[model samples]
Target chain A: MRYVTPRKAAVGLGASHTGTEHHWWMTVSSAALALLTPSFLMVMGTALQLPERADILLYFTRPYPAIVVAIFMTLGMMHFIKGSRIMIDDYLEHTARKVAIIGFSIFGWAVIAFTLFALARIQLAFAQAI
Target chain B: MADVNRGNRPLSPHLQVYQLPLAAITSIVNRAAGQAMVAGLLLLAFWLLGAAAGGGLWDWADWLTRSWFGFLVLLGSCWALWYHFLAGIRHFFYDAGEGLEIETARMTSIAIIAGSVILTLLSLIIYWI
Candidate 1:
């Protein structure tokens, strides 16, 4: 269907609310930005800018840089999710859309959770060495 | 859609309020985002490149952090990063069925600005290295 029927729209009270500009912004940003994220990650995977690199693990075992990494990962992961959430909302209109959305939703949460896990468990060897 | 009627007179399409004009707002968002993306990618790519260059170059980066110029640049980046982060949070709240009122929107606008600065300073102080 091109658009929601009036009756369906009435039943979709929260759905209409879900379909907002902010949601669109996040969705559009997520899908569009996803194109950039993987490239950046591949770069990070090879590079050693993380705190624990360069035989300097001892220097970086402090609290400040750890906080920085924690902030960066947490914010980046959350942004990635809301962004992809927007993409799912806008383009997934089929019957399997629910499953797709759920799957992606879990993936996003998993990324955030994993990032948090690393943030808490960061050690010089693993965190810095990549 | 039926045209809005007012006092028995047919009203023209209410081109939504463009306080500064639609083109201007779009231009603002586009330009700000463009500047941010350019700077952000450059920083990310440069850091990766530096890391790939090995220890000597990496040591130099650590030294740069001590310089006035580098510190200023990092400070600016902190602002940008936190600004984007807070804005993303605002967007998240909108997704969660909050922050839709006129008052709340204004609060979020100010809050994002304040939050960015506050978070940046807090992160800096709380940093590991």
Candidate 2:
């Protein structure tokens, strides 16, 4: 019933030298998101209700909403990158898996960057106006 | 030595062989919900980018979101968000060595499904009000 070969057991290597780093990051990010999700939802929900584009822009200028969006988008996308990688690994193989993992990771980061840039632009505009 | 009888060893039934339990369905749905939320994130990005750019881009983005199709997509995203949130909580508890019992797990799965639906409806209702 020995699954490990004698020579292999002697060498004792495991899948990726990283070892639980992915799991650890996922756990930490998910825990943070559990706390952040409600506030993030509230911020987004409020922003959506604003009547005009200017009002929506002004809404994000507030400290609370801006901060919530910043943290949530950053951490949420990082969590997504990890989660999607696991999903891609499970269902995809070879070139498809590698391409998907790379593509999704890049996409996740691009979203985070653009969203944060937008938030920053809004805040800066508000600052210059007042 | 283990290899001697490997071919004769009975393996567990594959995924399609048996009816999936509530917990399994919940688990897979959680993954699906996570995937679905990506759409929501992209929409959010679009809105933010438009807001930053202003003018036509902003108006177009605004119109798109307010459209019926956009509303439907958002509604699904809202449900997915809540579902995935609850599922994350369930997994947290599981990691803490709680709620692993069959009946408890099943009850929690049902709760996750029902709770997400209620939360989504409540959010929408509040939004419309």
For lDDT, the strongest prediction is: 2
Error of 2 at A114 (Å): 1.4
Give TM-scores for every candidate, taking all chains together and pairing residue i with residue i. 0.42, 0.88
lDDT per residue as tens, model 1, A2-52: 587887776634655654665566556554443443333333322333454
Query: Any runs in candidate 2 off by more than 4 Å, and if so which?
Result: A1-13, B1-14
Q: Which one is best on TM-score? A: 2
* Candidate 2 residue-wise lDDT, A4-107, digit = tens: 88866655344755666777788889989989988988888889888888899899998999999999989988899889988998999999999999999999
Error of 1 at A40 (Å): 14
Which whole-number lDDT from 0 to 100 does residue B34 have in model 2?
A: 94
lDDT computed for candidate 2: 0.89
Q: Give the TM-score of candidate 1.
A: 0.42
- Residue A74, candidate 2: alpha-carbon lDDT: 91
Q: Poorest 10 consecutive residues of model 1 chain B by lDDT? A: B22-31
